[model samples]
Target chain A: MTTTNLPAAATREALGPTLVRLQQNGANIVVVDADLGKSTSARTFRDAFPERFFTFGVAEQNMISAAGGLATLGHTVIASTFAVFAEHAFDQLRMSVAQPKLNVKVVASHGGVSTGEDGASAQSVEDYALFSSLVNFTVCVPADVVEAEAMVAAAVATPGPWYIRTGRPKIPVIYTDGPRFQVGKADMLREGTDVTIVACGLLVERSLRAAEALEASGISARVLNMGTIRPLDVAALEAAAKDTGAIVVAEEHLTHSGLGAMCAQAIAATTQPVPMEFVGVQSRYGESATWDEVLEIMGLTADGVEAAARKVVARKR
Target chain B: MVYGAQSGHIGGSMSSTEILAVLYGRIMRHDPKRPGWVERDRFIMSKGHCTPVQYATLAESGYFPVDELSTFRKKGTRLQGHSVLGKPEGVENSAGALGMGLSFGLGIRLGMRLSNIDAHVYVLMGDGEQDEGQVWEAAMAASHHRVDRLVAIIDRNGIQNDDFTAATMRTEPLDEKYRAFGWEVRAGIDGHNLEAVEEALAWARDVRGKPALVIFDTVKGKGVSFMENNPNFHGAAPSAEQFARAMEELA
Candidate 1:
């Protein structure tokens, strides 16, 4: 599939419109923000649906538990905050939302090092792992504005707990309008046979660039956007392992318990196990820098993904 | 039920028996046959460890068979050690961890008010459980939003797991603390007195435009003489001799 050349837009931009659209369509969507509505762009939803919006005033725990309560009353609840602050309310989310499988949508923004200049304290590289470990959660890291918008709509219509991680910086548009976004499905951005480069969130754009670079060097690299981290698309990973024989899993999260670990587990359980390489932060904290500078320093660039893809393919027996 | 379980929070359970009796028996508007009735007032036991009182109230209110009280914490029973939502009909929220009930109750009240559902949310929390920071967070939010039709009752038994709450975490001046957080505080009421508990409930319902809290000054084990204010029975089950005496005292 051809990539959309539209200008880069922050996932939060799409999130605002998506929430408004769902509310306009008569969805009983209530938004709760923990004083980060401006950053998470939940302010837009609050503006459109002021009556349905609530400001929890910097209390992430209260916001999450309140979301659970709203959900119990059959309201489609969207709780928004910075990803790092979400850790404060993990127990509340685990008990009130995940264990009970409440219909609460936690749309945490500023995921990973892309939250430039905030330093390690604000960056959330382990949120995906933390949320995915919950028993009944649909964890999604949207690849671009389009996918983020679609996933928010899908999450609202779908029941149970959901955690959709969006980034702070604006990333290139990877898909056209109305992408086919499912809860536990992976989107194949490109199909190939030599090697498969799997990625999610902002890294999907880098993976696409890496795939193009690999093709010029006579390597047929496939790109798969593993959006839903929990309830992973194991079938797609198995198919990729069977076909490509080598895989490179990339994400803007920690190497441990993130998408790489998830893919490794899936491949290990399969009959045909492929050589795999991980492209992510390797057990270190991030510092203040521009998004691109941090991505380069953390080895999360397209060159990094391309190098991992070649290394994995060379290790294929 | 506590005797049958052989292991339960009998102390705190007994302390809140009158409060539960007042709410489930006469105060709250609920239909036993229709536990999921939309118009029913939502009851969340935030201090979930003391679930024997809630289970007994639920059973007596006909949400489940009265005989099911024998299955408390037993295998193949809907009544677990802590109460869970949807396990037995009418249990609004699942809770074991402390300090979350008020927040959950605030959310339900906000949703009901926004949707024009016309319902009240009652959250039962323990005085010892006030140590959790999340409870204060919900308290601030509830008062900031001026969440009406939300009633928070604290089982202020003055004791926690190891020792007294004042020694454990100093949660005294609770009424002032709640008032400082903007809640309408009702303090120093006899929790064992059914009439006093009912009067407090009636007064809390009339105080509008903000959340109301009724702090019941209660004994840890109110009904039975041997267990009253005794920290040993906080989590300990009664033995045969103790159970016989406790049954006689309660009777």
Candidate 2:
């Protein structure tokens, strides 16, 4: 898909309108916010559906448990809060929502170091890892607003527990139109055979840019937007390893437990194992800075991905 | 069942037996034959460690065969160590971790209100479970929403796992605390007395525009002579000799 003229917007900005649409379409959807309706863009749903929206004041645990209760009664509940704050309700989410396979969509905003100026405490680089470890959880990190809206619809249509991590800042538009997003399916943005640049969330756009740069340098790079991390698309990873013989995984989360780890495991089990390079936060906390600055410090840029792609391609032989 | 399983919260279960009996027998509009009836009142046992009483009540109420009580805590059985929803027809929520039932009950009550279903949600909690911060969070929300269909009953057996609640962590002035949190508080009622339990629930049902709580004051192991007020029985199952003695005492 061509990226030119694609509309750029924050993932959080698409949450409210998308939820309203879901409710309008006869979905028994209820929106729950933990005093972050404005920040998480849940206020859009709150303003539209006053009766269906519930504001649990800074109480993420109670909000999550209540969401579970509401889900048990056959309500499709969307519980929103900052990604960092969602950690407070981990136990509740695990037992009440995940274990019971309740239909609760925990949409956490301000994911990763992109939540600039809030410092280390506000950044949630470990959310994907935390949620993916739970039983019966579908973990997603949409690359752009188009994917975000489609993912919200998909999450509602799909039953059971879901965890979606969205960024605070506006991300580059990767899809001109709403992409067909299926749980555990990867979107191949650009196809190549030299090396596959696998990425998710904010880093997907960076990987696309790196793929373009690699193309100019006479190196073909395949870009796979791995939106869903938990129910990971292992087939795509295996196909990439078989077709390209090398892989480079990138994410805004820590490299150890995020997409990189999942991709490594997938590749190791393939018929022909491939060499891989990881592009993510190297087991460290983010500081208070602009999103661009944090990206540069964490080596989460197109240049870093391009460099990793080159290194992995060299190790292929 | 506890003696048969050789593992259970016997003390807390004994203390809460009458409350469960009253709920499943005299109160709560529920049909044993139609356990999945849409308008049935929901019952959540927040202090889920005490499953023996709930299992007994469910059997006595005919929600399931009384013979199934023998499978409590056994492998591949619905009656696990803690309460699990859908495992038993009447078990509204799964609980083992303390201090989550009120929040879940509040959600059920709110859901019933939205669905236009006139049903009450009853949450049975342990006095020691109040120490968890999540309990107060749910309390504040229950009151803030004015969930009138919600009723929280605290089994104040005065003992925790290791010692008495007074010595472990002072949860005194609980009635004042609930009142401050905007709930209609009914405290100091004898949990063993069926008439008192019935009256408190009736009063709570009549309350409008606010949640209600009934604090039951009772001995830990009320029916058992040697187990009464004994912390050893808080989480231990009866031995062969002790089991015989208990059956005789209750008989």
lDDT tens digits, residue span A1-317, model 1: 55446668888776777899989998999999988888888999989989999999989998998899999889999999888998789999988999889999999899999987878898898998899888899999999889999899989999989999999898888786558778789999899999998899998989999999899999998999999998899999999999999999999999987999999999999999989999999999999999889999999999999999989988985
Could you give the CAPRI-style class of model 2?
medium
Each model's iRMS: 0.7, 0.8
> lDDT of model 2 at residue A166?
90
The per-residue C-alpha lDDT of model 2 at residue B126 equals 94
- In the range B112-229, model 1's lDDT, one tens digit per residue, is 9887888889999999999999999999999999898999999999999999899899888999999999989899999989899999988987789989999999999887898988
After superposing candidate 2 on the true structure, give the runs of residues whose Cα lies further than 4 Å from its correct spot: A1-6
The CA lDDT at B95 in model 1 is: 92
lDDT of 2 by residue, B1-251 (tens): 98889998999998998898888888899998998898998899999898898988888998899999999999889999998888788888889999888888888888888889889989999999989899999999998887897999999999999999899999889999999999999999999999998998888877889999999998899988999999888999989999999999999
What TM-score does chain A of model 2 get? 0.98
In terms of lDDT, the poorest run of 10 residues in model 2 chain A is: A1-10
TM-score of 1: 0.98
